[model samples]
Target chain A: MIRLHRCCIALLMASAPVAASAASPIELTARVLVEQRQAAADGTTRIVLVPPARVTPGDAIVYTLIYRNTGSQPVPDLVVASPVPGNLLYAGPAEKAAVPEVSVDGKAFAPLAQLRVDGRPAIAADVRALRWRIAAPLTGGAAGQVAFRAIVK
Target chain B: MMNRILSPVALLAGTGAGLLIAPQALAQQVRSGTAAGVSISNQATVSYSVGGSSLTTSSNTATFVVDKKINLAVAELGGTPTIVARGATDQVTTFTVTNLTNATQDFRLEADQQDVSIPLLGTDDFNVTSVRVFVDSNGNGTYEAGVDRATFIDELAPDATVTVFIVANIPDVAGITQANVSLNAIAANSGQAGTLGGDVVATPLTTPDSPTTVDIVFADDTGLLDQPRNGQQRAFDAYRLGSAVVTLRKSARVLSDPVNGLASPHAIPGAVVEYCITVNNAGPNVANGITVTDALPANTDYISNSLTVGGIGTGDTCVLNGSIEDDDAVGADESDPYGGSFDGATVRATLPSVTPLVPLNVGFRVTIR
Candidate 1:
């Protein structure tokens, strides 16, 4: 009777449906861009975006991060983080999203109002790294973008 | 006849005995006269009556030896030698001139350079300009212009000493191992009045002595006839003029965007470059009022308020970040050890003082245009 019962349990476990492993749905890409102003024939200035190779002091540069859900299902609790280069000073966020959190040492993160440097409220220039938390789920085949601007010190 | 014979015999015997005692007394008197500090005299009294009464009287006699002696001795006041720098004036040497004379007298001062022969040390001779002699009024052993009396020492009392200053200028020359200056003081005649006292008399007793006195006269009770004439004393001092040695070194480096971050920084536009000027004083003397200047390099512009002057400590690290200011303007901080200013395209930094074997650094930053 014990052997018959054990065989019945194994068959029942084998007949149950097996769950498949989930694949990462979000894909990320980052790049740095510089702005160039050209004079139009009408005597008006127009800004042109170009890839950055070399920059002079007091020049402004932009960092952009793009994300797309590559899988069929939606991605939740998505977090993207980018560090401000040591030689560049953080100016401000490039886009308006859920206000991004900033870190002075690239270790701890907090909202802009809560971030403190040397026991005092930190300014934008003190930011060393920034992180964004997506509030809405990232739908499949949907792309999202975020960016920040900095000056070459 | 018997009475007459007795009287004659007695008279002869008495006369002979008196004569013998008189000779012995004369020999004793001569022996006593040879001793020092002793006076001898003898008196005889005679009683005689011309007509009826007797009279007595004695002759008066006085004897003394006069003292007329003058001696001059001089010596250097301080045992240590003096140090004099080239082209320095009023390099004074103090001396004490004491009058060993029994009477008041004057002394004339003169400084003469002695011939020195030190191998490898430049010629021992150097011209001493603006030689002035003065009597130290305060007796502090240091020369003070207004306090000291620059006058001929007249009427130096017997056994009195006076301090003398021989001021002279050192010529601008090097390698002087032993620059000897001799101060000579010679005794002058009585009533001599002048900076250069009247020429020494030919003889201390001459009615009108010669320009220079030959001998000093001394008369005493001992009746000694030999005494030195107008005496001269001398004091010498040797001076060593040291050299002031200084060396300067300059280095420049770009503080931003170094090619390898460790060495060989590239000079790029809009980059900051720091220049360091090191001034070293290796001599034994302290250097004062040291000024360092550097012109802004071509293709670069000076960064205002970026200058910093400091002292190079043990390992060439900059210490004392002195306050910077515009050229000739007062700095906000007064305790800074250095002061800097800009004139046109050049940066000037002034250091208050620098000691031997110490290095001072003057640095400033400039941005390439």
Candidate 2:
């Protein structure tokens, strides 16, 4: 039984690289963090971000995305796109990025004020997806991250 | 490098169809925020060109569940104070308790007496008797006696409003013009339908989110006395007094006699005597349906067609006004609206309305045998 189990594991390891080579060389990771307000000892309020243990409506959350180019050659035109969940409203970008654009219907991307929904100027709540285009080419073994803040509706 | 398998790239909005394109249209309908126990998932996709070849990959989905938000509102329905007469019973002051939370909940009701003056209402100088709280069982906004008898709300739906009442009895004590009362609604545990739930005393959780377990968060607005996030809310209403204070005085004197006609006479046998009863009202409101009766003395006969009402007078003197009334209780004189009549042994007068600070005098004549 042990020899059979080892043979099955060896066969799985052999096919793993074949699947990885067919996919993109850029690796992406996503995480969700909750924003909490704490009263400091100095009579000041401090905002702390922690992994969500209990999340209620009207709470603020930050979605962070990290990517790295694993290939030997430089990768160009790196674009990161994320959609605002139906249960959440897009507050704004957590950190400024290159050429950030928002979409009201997920198909048309533009600045928040430039986008219109049903003949009216679109607001942050109308945003369904967000995309950012990295201006600089990503060199091999280079890593970067992008984030956005959203409020649970 | 190992990669987790990801779902297909489809950016469809959740639940409602117009949630993405027309949030304003969905807002027009009554709705609260996201409900508890709902899972929210997020994923991101990255695309780039490697060595002149295009490539794309998606990230693993990050998900969390929404906890419960306990919120509600209590409001006095009427802007003006409820007018109540002195010694009035079961006078009702109405309010509305709304469940603003995202889930169905039961609310415990309480009635409290206040001493401070209500806004736009007079100062509260007295307390109402037998104060009680009740929920409107019948959907009607008005409070019905014995019909709307629910004491606490049961399983009230989210964004729904229910009427409540503070039923009390006004004191008969003098100079008590206003009484203030308030209703408080506290969040309570939900139980079987048509049953009052146990009190849900809020001890806010001190720890972080549990992700799988639904935690409670008090998000109610501040009340007149209660602070925000206390799971309770309160509102005040007042009862104003609308009553009349009336006083009566009676006096008699000799008018004339069969032997000394039109001269100074005494209360001797066969002498004609006149009795006057004055009705005065010192009130903040008019007195209605006032009736005064004076019975003749033994061995004395009621003088026919001598009854008079609404006579102008102060002290012991009175001057008869209008036409004279008759001896029979039934006649056009009795329907004069301010008329009097004699029923053999007694002289009776009826006045429909007695204005404030106005004196109404009733007079009749009788002859001693």
Candidate 3:
């Protein structure tokens, strides 16, 4: 009797659309930090990033996006998108495993060289959002991070 | 003896008959005069016949004197010069209007900017905001808002004086060294004349001892009728403006890690730079509406939330112990001395008011891209 019930439930799940039955297994988080100069025990100064409690104009800020796969199976063709805050001007993305594409209106995406504004090539200042495409599949319990810099307007 | 007695008796009887029968027939005469001792007297007589004999009697004389007169004078209370600043309100000059008349009278007050030209400096004309005639209710001679009453000198008693305040707003103009304003007081019944009533002819007498008649004839010391006495009582005040000077200085330092720990910092990519801007005002007067702005350096990214302000030492040294104020860390208990904000590339700081000799320091950090 238990085997018959399991078979019947499997048939019902199969009748539904495959895309509708599937669930996203990826988790994402965003964080911001500011750079500061600190002195080491050896009397040498080093640049370090720290969480910011306050910011002023002309201050540089770093935004980081973290991703993790929580499902039993591998997640393929993963893409991440982040919108730049209005009060900050886009600088550039930090070095990462995959190159990132930029958007001026958060609609269309293209490489940094192909992006244009007012029929002219777009500069770093014109970027409004960032998109990253991961080439390698993320296995369950696997994680990765992407970051970019911006200056307060 | 019989004739004499008959004649005396006849006279007495005639007088009695005249008093009783022709009392209305006797004419009583009167003459007009002024309080200046112009003589005025009245007399009356009566006549009648008794038993074919004629006799007459004369009555006693009556006299009266008029005492109607009004006079007033206005003078500056003190010759001291008043000091005023441009763009200042409630600048006041005081004067005393005295009613010298023997009878009570009302005086109208007026203020005007005189045509006194100071060609060397500039035009000294300024309009008065308001003119108030106040009776020193407290006898303090100083005008108090709620204590002093704002009204004309209505029925000012003889030998009574009232203080008049001419309030004016000084305009903001350059090269204005001095200002002259005149105050005048004339009797209310001066018939549109500019002087007190003393100089004008007294109104035609309708009734004896009427105070109104005195106003028509009261004249000022200048013998002018219904005009301001004491020649408008001009008051001169001096105007002085303070010179304001402000100076701003800025400095920046870069900090970066070197291959050798003992080496100094280099301005390489990813290096952090700190900037300090100091503003000083050397002035005799406070500088109002002060603002400081600094554009972010090229090829640099501003460290988000890194803007701060602190009181610095005499030099460019940043005092760590000094109260460090953060633009983003404003809490309910904390207050920012200067309003600060950023517009992508530039940082702005606004100070509502600042006094002279005070130095203001503002600091922020940026990173090289």
Highest lDDT among the candidates is held by which one?
Answer: 2
DockQ of each: 0.00, 0.40, 0.00
- Name the docking class for model 2: acceptable
> Per-residue CA lDDT of candidate 2, range B28-78, in tens?
322557877788988787878776775667776778887778888999997
Cα lDDT, all candidates? 0.59, 0.79, 0.55
Q: Model 3 RMSD to the real structure?
A: 54.1
True contacts kept of 3: 0.00
Segments in model 3 whose C-alpha atoms lie over 4 Å from true places? A1-153, B1-64, B118-135, B189-215, B223-369
The number of residue pairs in model 2 that clash at the backbone is 3
In the order shown, the chain A TM-scores of the predictions are: 0.75, 0.83, 0.77
Ranking by lDDT: 2, 1, 3
Question: Model 3 — TM-score against the truth?
Answer: 0.32
What is the lDDT for B343 in model 1? 63
Local accuracy of candidate 1 as per-residue lDDT tens digits, B222-302:
111113443566666655555455567787778774344536657777777878777776544678888888888899888
lDDT by residue (B184-226, candidate 3, tens digit) is: 6656543333333443245443534331122233334552122
Q: Model 2: DockQ against the native?
A: 0.40
Span of 10 residues, lowest total lDDT, candidate 1 chain B: B37-46
Off by over 4 Å in 1: A1-153, B1-64, B117-128, B138-140, B172-178, B192-197, B202-215, B218-230, B242-369
Model 2 chain A lDDT-worst window of ten: A14-23
